[model samples]
Target: MKRSTPQEAPEVQVETSGQLPPHAAGYARDKVRAVLGQAPEPVLFARVRLARTANPAVERPVTAQANVDVNGRPARAHVAGHTATEAVDLLQDRLTEQLARLAQHWEARRGRMPVPGSHEWRHGSEPTHRPDYYSRPVEERQIVRHKSFSLVRESPDEAVFELESMDYAFHLFTDADSGEDSVLYRSGPTGYRLAQVHSRPHPAGNVAVPLTVSELPAPRMTVAEAQQRLEATGFPFVFFADAGTGRGNVLYHRYDGHYGLITPAE
Candidate 1:
């Protein structure tokens, strides 16, 4: 079936955490996390600034950004609010609905289940209409966004140290020698790298789902090496014939009832 454009899909942005004041910064920060975290864990970005809106002399508003990873392709959800209550709203309806719909696409492709929007509601299923509901488009979409992050510059040792210390799965950095953008991080059993080429433009509006991506082992990559390394892994994935105006991505997973092994790629 046809799916709505990414613009139609709620833009999923990782929470960008902003800066806070000394006396109330930590406390407010904790409160913000507690409130926003009420929803299931998903990659989010929160940009915070601790500054006086009225005073031009304030310290640059103390602007900073904090981001969490999504299940698939590390999509981000923005969580920002004047108070904690507003932050919580982003998690459930907007974030949850988008992820669920994306997952449904993958499950349908796998022939494991019906499209998420379809069900016999007339029978007995309660109105589970979630908040931040997204309308489905009317078109056939079989494939979604599938991308890999390759690494550059830092050696494997530096990459491992930074990722481990920060407790992050992947790091997007520019290569010193090749001067190209690359990703270094872990996924699955070993570390993996993707040579991000200017060729593969960022998909504009596809929703990203939370998938189980671990830091895989890797020797890091130069731009040239990463492209050659493509298709080396046996991870089975289907590419969409029509990637759409922007990058279209869906999270496919193995079925175990309602739960499935979610892969970040199409």
Candidate 2:
């Protein structure tokens, strides 16, 4: 008997968080669908969200967000522009780059093509999706909240799973491969990225070995489940993946104790 290949399922979904023109919504949905059609593997689903920024005069008032689910893996990207159509076009390009990389990684592993033998492949290029604010000179920013937490040991994929399943802007963990302190953070609209913490710079000008942070285990859960956990623990915030989009999100307790949401934007 011969084994049958699993069927592919690549569906595109588009919805607006705020009031949006029907043409804009349709354009976004169509763009994502056309891009995913080129994916080497079956994209489980792709979701696009469009919204207008509060600042009317902003150069990029129209924000577009796209989330792609490949197999059980999730990837997200976003872009902004003056119009929904322009934003969606850029969003498609970003999504194409992401899916291309995923395809490269998987294909290389399967020996389908010569392992990516480029300089960027050997030495990872600086991520282009990071926000512009990060490049600006550091201002008088102070650590408003400093709490020590144990560093969990996990792979990059597992780290993302943990980060999404808990209420934290970032997660510091020991890389299972390198055994070094690593930070997983959501840098702007590029989704999640990992940084290796070499050494801590002391405020007083002396280097430190860093506090022996304790590891906080995170369990994968849906957004609704995360909200329930947040309410049960009386915690200020809860982080988890949106079941519908497979994207990370934060549900926080507002001043009035009502729920507030924070999600990646372009």
Candidate 3:
């Protein structure tokens, strides 16, 4: 009888949009493979997208984004640069950092001590450069993206870990303790703040990390009303409870200046 060999996992597929260099896709594939190849957990699915804006006024027209499912947990990174190669380089760096942090998180969750010098958590090192917002006037901006899904239910600590590892400015989830729709975001360089549909004071000992609950509850309004407030206030984003469904919703400004909305699925 002949011995059979195990099949190797398929290579991650890279996708490109807008006008990119002919070699952009291949270059991105090589970079992604190099990073995901060394992931601590098995990569079940991975996708890379590279897009370029045709507008000349944008300083960083090239944008690169990557999403990877590592052992059932998802990790994501998004970055922008002046060129395709530069963007891919930044993407690789960001992905590597996120994965390292995620590995440390998993180790802690499993009651294992993280390897010394394996990773570092620095709030000051978070990426500051973001793609320029669209030059279009705010009044002309429209809601270009709307995402609806069942919000995850997790502890505040778990939500903070996901927010950092996924490079999200804000994370929306259901509070496991209070059973309320909540949004978690960075408060300052070192602390985090939580806003919920029905705001309530939380005991300081409830969360291990430095977290504060918002005194003001999430505003109740329709999508249209939220849009108007966003335009009037020029806030980076708005978190509210949908008046009709009473579910948590986030209306934020995209890098392109267009509005993007995230809401819980009914």
Candidate 4:
């Protein structure tokens, strides 16, 4: 596992039109007042903008956020909501309650609770229902098929685009020369990881490779890092890992060894 010092998120610049929305602007005002231990008087509200997850077709509810300029500095929040109205209400209520409480909390603990932001969680144990669209008729199914096929021996990048185009969470491919096997998979917060097969892959192919390829544990990184690392490694001849999410983050289960760090690959 590669460890690097953590860096905080960059500040957001809030644009303005010499006005603020009633709900959006008030929410910001409330947050500042919360910390000041008084009603909003000197504070000036700049702007309120509505932002949401890019994809709307997915069944999962989208999250909304707000960026407000309090006094002359910037204060922001990324609260949860499925709709604009719901998001506005959430911001209103949260700002109203917390701003006043901020001063109290800070005084008591010498800090304000870390403002909430987007987060994702992973699950444990095996899935009871292994749903399959591969078998389901295409007319009724979203996924047409997960046809098992062979790929020309090459780097993992060639295979990654294949998965992205097909919208696959993972892929099994042939390695150059050594005829070794590996899997490119995505699970949980860890977008994707490379697994070089050091051992046998799942035999049935009826489900996700039941077998772990590498003994190394999963890595803590983003999809981009995973691909970069695999490219750097020159496709070592070994069994690949199965990437998935857990309580911590996306992890990779090695073919034989304990799942280790799957950190961002430079």
Candidate 5:
């Protein structure tokens, strides 16, 4: 059994879009220190974010988020409470559990599965459900976030690794061998899928294209991989080069939520 020897606690940086109360600030620092104290390796850095939320729960009107980087791996947790102090306590508990799981996951991969019945408390101890964003009204469904990154050419396996490492639900990359645009995403805890796009752009409506088009480099990949990318992104369609024939193709989502592939006939 490996134990973490405590040294100096890493600095905790707190950022707030709105003002945070002084007591809340102090509580956040203390809770973060408590969580990091249990980490297998000293946390490289820790961050706390405080924000007001629209939640109607009287006991959880504020949201707290903790992000910690440990030995190049990152773990994060979010909690809400009526008071900043309550939120800080919850966040501390969550971050501690997450860090423990991270360490255990690495260890389990090295042929050490925890004795199942011996640790019944650890089994399913964490909440597995996620809030359903679609439950919100359509009028409130506008995009609230945007992220941009360069497309790296990678295989399905490589894309899977990247997705997990970044803690993202999906990943986009060009296929190194097929020269097609592809995406990788988790279908379940134990499974992953891929999608790819067509090589050429489809006919568009009578609307002007974006004034700025990013001339991105494309990589060759399998059609199956391209299809997965198309599905994961929830895009209306995707355009990419055909890995098989090096021709342009289009993968589109149908009204029935199924996928359709359009390729120029040779």
Candidate 6:
């Protein structure tokens, strides 16, 4: 008779950029493993990136980002600090919190109460410092990235869960109830707001989370128009219905100071 042991999952893959310390990659891998190892669900894949800025003026020169797939769900976290060690430490904490919130969402779906001592998660006030955008003139910037995909159809609460766990500033999806393309984002420190292609009042009782629907309708504009408006308004992003297709699209500023567009797949 023979006994066999189950193989353990592989260590997290770590990537580095810029002039990082030699031990930076290994340290990040260990830190990421420490966090994902305690995940409530199986971690299918995990990758961490550590980057350093050469500019000394940047307060937080070291940035760390992690993307992980827990079972079938995706979660992500990004953080920055003065040093690689600090950045990795912050990443671990943020990733752990994200996974916990995700696990809570799963528990609720199963009609089970949240674990003991677990409280409702709220948006933190910490600012994530991304790469500084070059001072390129808006007129010179071009639409460098265009992403097209099928939007998920889900409830507001589910969308919120995904948005926070994935560390997205805004999430574009199809509203399950209204069947309209919608964007969900943080309204304030503790609340969320929803914007729909056809603006209409949403019944508060239908949504379980703290949410408010936008009263103004999404503007219909072409990509070029949206880009001009974004430049004029200095808004982080613009959500609008495409003038040509009548589908929702998002025009936003990338970290590189270029325009990026997101549209639903045809």
Stretches > 4 Å off in candidate 4: 1-46, 52-56, 60-63, 69-74, 105-266
* lDDT of the structure predicted as candidate 1: 0.32
**What is the lDDT for 132 in model 3?**
65
* After superposition, candidate 2 runs with Cα above 4 Å error: 1-9, 114-118, 121-173, 184-266
Report the lDDT tens digits of candidate 1 across residue range 52-128.
23233332222222333433323222333343334344333333333443344455666777533213111111112
* Candidate 1 vs candidate 2, TM-score winner: 2
Candidate numbers, best TM-score first, in rank order: 6, 3, 2, 5, 4, 1
Give per-residue CA lDDT, model 3, range 1-266, as digits (tens): 22222223348788898999999999998898888876767788989999999999988999999998887889999988999999999899899888887777667666676432312444454645345677688677889999999999898877888887888989999988788899998877677889999986773235656777899989999999999998889877899999999989999999887889999988
Per-model CA lDDT versus the true structure: 0.32, 0.56, 0.82, 0.36, 0.57, 0.82
Model 4: per-residue Cα lDDT over 134-225, one tens digit each: 12221332211223334446444444434432333355565443454556654434244555544333322222211223445334444435
Q: State every prediction's TM-score relative to the real structure.
A: 0.24, 0.52, 0.87, 0.27, 0.50, 0.90
Model 5 per-residue lDDT tens digits across residues 30-64: 87887787676667988998765444533345677
Q: Top lDDT: which candidate number?
A: 3
Per-residue lDDT of model 2, residues 1-266, tens digit only:
22223344366787786556679988887788887777766778778878865544455567777887777666677666667777788788777767666666566567776544322221122233221221112243222332334556676555544444232346656677666555565543334545443322211222111222224423346656876787688654665545664434555654222455654331
Residue 46 lDDT in candidate 6: 94
Stretches of candidate 6 exceeding 4 Å from the true structure: 1-9, 114-119, 126-135
> What TM-score number comes out for model 6?
0.90
Better of 1 and 2 by lDDT: 2
lDDT-wise, the better of 1 and 5 is: 5
